[model samples]
Target: MINYEEILNSSVVDIKPSGIRKFFDIAEQMENVISLGVGEPDFKTPWHIRQAGIDALEKSKTRYTSNRGLIELRREISSYYKRKLNLDYSPESEVLVTVGGSEAIDLAIRALINEGDEVIIPEPSFVCYVPIVKMAGGVPVIINTKAENEFRLTAEELKGAITEKTKMLILPFPNNPTGAIMEREDLEKIAEILKGTNIIILSDEIYSELTYGNSHTSIAQIGEMQERTVLISGFSKAYSMTGWRLGYILCPAPLCKQMTKIHQFCIMSSPTVSQYAAIEALKNGDDDIASMRAEYDVRRTYVVNEFRKMGLSVFEPKGAFYVFPCIKSSGMTSDEFCERLLKEKKVATVPGNAFGECGEGFIRVSYCNSLGNLKIALSKIKEFLKENKNG
Candidate 1:
């Protein structure tokens, strides 16, 4: 047999598989599993968005777009950002369409990091940031955000993690798994700390459209910080366009130029049909976002209340479709809690440790499914908790 290990990149080999996927695989093999594990929206792409993709196909618009993406789509993205977030970018120079926000993040990290440079990541946030930073030849520096602060990365935490080697800081809010959001004041403090530094902020705002109570704020919206922030977003969560694989990155022209080079060689451009559909989503999808957000809000409330009633300590999530509840009260590690719950109750939830080490005593439960399904999952979880409660 060929020595595959000898040929593989050492860095890639060292990275472990995603912690979320293991339980998902087990659930997939089981019958009648009520999964609260995956972070995808249960909603289908809104009718108009789907229709636009269909129309594009009917018109035979299947060729590759410009390496930077279709100009019209970029322009729509520019206008949408300006109107919704008060952030401005020149479409012709500062925007690059990507396969998904995943690509945009990869491009940004690869373009910016040199070997041994340190990239600070706040967790439990997203699973991709550390590995992407490592793949880019950068050192992964982690700052474990606390549940006491609702998992928002404090300015103090950022300052503590920074050193001469620090090159990038990933800001993922409204965060995944934890469902934590950094409000304006929280972001302002972070902006202040980063004001004079060379540290680039890779702000992943994929869940921006899902925030409830207060509007989502980007560090890019802060004046001095805008020049250093690469803002990434996609249609996956908000518009239910996950399979369409369309996303974009907005950065200062200089950074955009570098990121586009990586994107050009690696991806060339996002899918043409998806680009057309994304344009429709940006222009005519406000009602769709509102409808979905309202529905999620109901599910969010129900899930939080149910978890609390079970005597589990769950921080109220203000955004995203997830709730991270402390499983410590059940006297089990996150992994044990999830495994036992899956085996006994037939409900699947991702262990919080999938997101980071700080997630050890918690489990992430996504509320992206229907209210009826969530109710069933919650009841199953309640039964599991009762059986496993700490003495």
Candidate 2:
């Protein structure tokens, strides 16, 4: 009766719901589902980190922090980058704590984009980039990174996607669904191409600590690229602090000043207890990260091998906790493959196209569950494939 459609924002209305959550919701209603659809870590928040939050509550440290966040937390973040990657930032000026890495990304996009500006994004990567770009009145320019290249955005791909209107390049390495990583050599080529451009690199390194075999590399670490890069990261994947909702951004002082204003108006401060916990995580969480990364490495190998054995052409993921295996052999679209697999076999997976159009024939399977669950899910998938072929 109330014409809510006419009153609602068209831009928001036009955006599609996340493809990743489609099968996940279906799996939730069904009985005995083995779902590998989400990227959440199955690990608990380390006790010391949890204790820090509890300690903060007991001490009544519940008031809002500065719009930029607690100075001590910012300092710990600064110390973290310095210790881990030999990167430096002035805690007083360049670091801003955020609600999560997702919010940090939103703040960066909103602060930087004006009407009709174009942002280059590589896919199949994270689902949030394109929608966020559009919400900021920025055009989404997608470059489909190929499986042959391990889904890394090649310099040629970046160079070709650039135009006079391009303002930002979202480098989502150690990427989400694909588990792709851009090595230092790979990033240097990208740096060379953008050397003289005004395009800002929004390097979403939320999965940085999860890389296996080789350590993660940020585009910000390449040459003088740091001056033009807005580095975003969080404790979700690394320290299993997802529900704690703490993340931070590091960039040049000028950009930091503007992004902080956006964060100030939209979110005056991040969670105080979470900030306290993050400080402890930054201080004493190396062993926790190492142990978690080691466990994920084992799972990654197992998942990749299992998918390959099922006769799916699986790209060996070097980062993140997912395996994007090509399911074209089943003669089904990604959506059909996942839907049928879910209904018939009781195992849930995300269709690759949820990440982008290029992900059409692939399926993203997260290996975040226990080895026992993974074995069960993988076996069910193998059975599904056999039935598909026989039918």
Off by over 4 Å in 1: none
Top model number, lDDT: 2
Q: Candidate 1: give the clashing pairs.
A: none
TM-score of model 1 relative to the true fold? Answer: 0.99
TM-scores of all predicted structures: 0.99, 0.99
**How would you encode candidate 2's per-residue C-alpha lDDT over 215-314 as one tens digit per residue?**
8888888898999999999989899999999888999999999999999999999999999999999999999999998888888899999888888998
The per-residue C-alpha lDDT of model 1 at residue 229 equals: 94
